[model samples]
Target: MDTKRFISFEGLDYSGKTTQIKRLKEYLEGEGFKVYTIREPGGTKISEKIRRILLDKAHVNMTGRCEIFLYSAARVQLVEEQIIPLLKKGYFILADRYVDSTTAYQGYGRGVDLEMVRLINEAATYGIMPGTTFYLKFLPEQVNKRTKLSGRELDRLEAAGLDFYQRVFQGYEKIAENNKNRFVVIDANQGIEQIHQKIVEVVKKRTLEEL
Candidate 1:
C-alpha cells in the first residue's frame, strides 16, 4: 500500500467535484484501503461553524481579507483536529476542497494577495500539501450553464457572479501550472465515467511510484 496519501479535488462549483470525490472514495475503499474523506471548511465542529458563515448568502458584505482568515481558521482546525490524526492511523485522506480553494476563490477570485494566501495556507497545514490534486477544468460560462441546470440554490460564493468565477477559473489554471508535479488537470467536460477513469489511472500510477 502507498504511504497514507493526501489527495484533494479542486474546481469551480457545479464542476462535479462532489460526484467525482464520492466515486473515488468508494473505489479506494473497495480496494481495501482505509480511505477518509472530508469537505473543506467543515470537517470539524468549529470548522463547520465557520463554513456556515462563509456560505451564508446574506453575508454579502464579508470582506476579502476576512474571508481569507475564516477559511484559514477553518482549515487549521480541520488539519489539526482531523487530518493529522487520520493520517497517523494510515487512512488515505481525500478532501473535496482544500487550501487551493482559498487560493483560487479568495486570492484570485476576490483579488486578495496571492502571496499572503499561500503563506497562511502553508502555515495552517503545517506545510502539508496534497501529494496529488485532481483539478476538474471548466470554463466560467460552462459553469454558469451547469449551475442553472443543477437546480441547486446559489451560495454566497456562487452568487458572486460569472465574472468572479472566470477569474477563479483562470486562477486554478495558474495554480495548476505553478504546481505541475502535484496537480493533475482533468477535463471536466468529458463524460463522467471518462473523467473518473482518468483520475483512477493517475491515482494508481502515482500510488505505485510513491509507495
Candidate 2:
C-alpha cells in the first residue's frame, strides 16, 4: 500500500478536525490531487450502520468490549471496501479518525487492555497504517467549552465525561510520544487559519519527501 497517500486526523469531538480536513481537502484539490475524505466507523454501507450504533446515545449500555469489536468491524469493512481501493487508484485519503481513537478512547478511557486493543486495531486495519497522522491536541475542559458554545447535543462517546476524556487525552499523548515519526501534534487552541497553514505546510513537505 502507498501509505504516504493515507493521512488521518485524530482528536476529541469539537477539536476542529473536521474544519482542518475540509481546508486540507480543498487545498489538495487545488494542487491537482484527487482527495478522498472519509470518517471512521463509517465510509461504507455496513460501516455507516455500525457508526449509528456506536454513536447512538440510547446504546448507553454498550460495553467497552462490544464497542471495540463494533468499531473494528466497521474499520475492516471500510479498509477492504473503500480505503484500499481508493489508495490503489492514487487518491489522497484523509481519514477523520482511525485505530488511534480506539487505543485512546477504549483502551485508556474505557479501561480496556492496551495489548488487546493493539491486537484488535491491527486486525481491523489489516496492518494498514497511515504515513502521517495529525493529532489535534486539546484538553477535555477546552473541548467542553467548545461543546457548550456550539449548543449541540452530546453523542454516546462525547458524553463520556471529563474524567474519561482526561484518560483518553493522556492516552493520545502516550501514543504520539511512541509514534513520533508518524504523528504530528497540532495545538487545537491555535487560530483556525494558523492550524490550516501548518497542516498545509506539513503535507507539502511530506509529499515532496515521499516523491
Candidate 3:
C-alpha cells in the first residue's frame, strides 16, 4: 500500500461529481482503506461560509474576479483546517472538487485570466495536488438535463452560456495534455456502472488490494 495518496474528481457543475465521490468512497472503504472525503468551498466550517457567498443565487452579481478569490480562500482554509491533517494521518483523501474548478469555471468558462486563476490557487492551497485526478468530462447540456440546478439557472461562470462551457471542457483537456502522468480523463457519458468500472481500474492500478 502506498499509504499516502490524495484523489479528486473535477468537472463542471451538474457533472455527477458528488454522486461519484460518494460511490468511490464506499468502494474504497469496502476495500478496507482509510478514507476521508471532502468538497471544496464547503468542506470545513469557515470555508462552508465562503461557499454560500460563492454559490448562492442571490450572489449572481459577483464579479468574475471576486468569485475566483473566494473559492481560493475557501480552499486555503480547507487545506489548513481539514485535508492536510487527514493526509498526514495516512488517510486517502477523496476530494469532490478542488483548484481545477477555478480553472474550468472561472478561467475558461467565465473568461477570467487563466494565469490569475493559477496564481490564486497556488498561493492559497498548501501544495496538495492529487496523486490522481478523475476529470468527469461532460457537456453542459447533458449536465443540465440531469441536475437542472434549480433555485438559479447557473452562476455567472456556469451561466456564461454553452459556448463557454465548451471552452472550459477544452481547458480541462489542456491541463491533462501535459500532466498526463497524474490526470485521468474519463468517459463520463457512459452508464454509471461502466464509469465505476473504469474508476475501479484506475484505483486498482494506483492503490492496490490483495483480494
Candidate 4:
C-alpha cells in the first residue's frame, strides 16, 4: 500500500471517530509506517487555543458567523503549523476532523451559507485535502445517548440541539456524495473493531493497485 498518504476520519460527535483514528494510527505505526494523528480545531498550538475559545460553553453567546470564521482560522493554522509539514515529511497524516465538520455543523446545522463555509475552509487550508476521508454515519439521537457528560458541562456545539444535528448529519452525507472520490461512508453502528476492519478493507480495496 502507499503507506505515505494523508487520511482523515470524519463524523458528528460521539461517532467513535477519535477512537478509530487512534487505533488506525497504532496499527500503522506498529507496522513500521510513519503515522501522524490530529484533531481539527486543534492540532497546532494556535489552533488549539482558538479551539478552546470557540468550543467553550461560555462561548454560547458567540455569533454563528464568528464561530465559523474561528473554525476556519484554526484550520489555517493547523495546515501551516502541522499538517502540511508532516505530509511533506512523508507521514501518513490522519485527522480526526477537518473542513467537513464546519461544513456540516456550521453550514447545515447552524444554517450558515454552505458555499461561504466551503470558501472559508478552502482559504484556510489552501485546498490541502486528504487523499481519503472516512465519514462515520449515525443518527444524532444515537450520538447524544452515547455522550457521557454528567457533571461536565457541554460546549455550545456539543450542546447544540438534536434537530440541528440531524441537518448536520444530512449535510455530511451530501458532502460525501458531492465529493465521491475523496469520501468514503462507513456504517458507524458497527463495533470499534469492526469499524476498524471496515476501514482497512476500504484502504486495501482502494489502494490495492497503488500499494
Query: Model 1, stretches more than 4 Å misplaced?
Result: 1-4
**Model 4 accuracy (lDDT, Cα):** 0.84
Query: What are the Cα lDDT values of the candidates?
Result: 0.89, 0.94, 0.79, 0.84
lDDT of 4 by residue, 77-98 (tens): 8888888888778788888898
In terms of TM-score, which candidate is stronger, 1 or 4? 1
What ranking emerges by lDDT with the best candidate at the front? Answer: 2, 1, 4, 3
Candidate 1, run of 10 with poorest lDDT: 1-10
Angstrom error of the Cα, residue 158, model 3: value is 4.3
lDDT of 3 at 155: 57
Error of 1 at 89 (Å): 1.0
Query: Where in model 3 is the C-alpha error above 4 Å?
Result: 1-4, 148-158, 209-211
Among all windows of 10 consecutive residues in model 4, the one with the lowest summed lDDT is: 202-211
RMSD of each: 1.7, 0.8, 2.8, 2.3
Model 2: lDDT equals 0.94
Model 4 compared with the native: what TM-score? Answer: 0.93
Residue-level error in angstroms, candidate 3, position 40: 1.6
Which numbered prediction scores highest in lDDT against the true structure? 2
Q: After TM-score superposition, what is the CA distance of residue 182 in candidate 1 from its true location, in Å?
A: 0.1
Q: Estimate each model's TM-score.
A: 0.96, 0.98, 0.89, 0.93
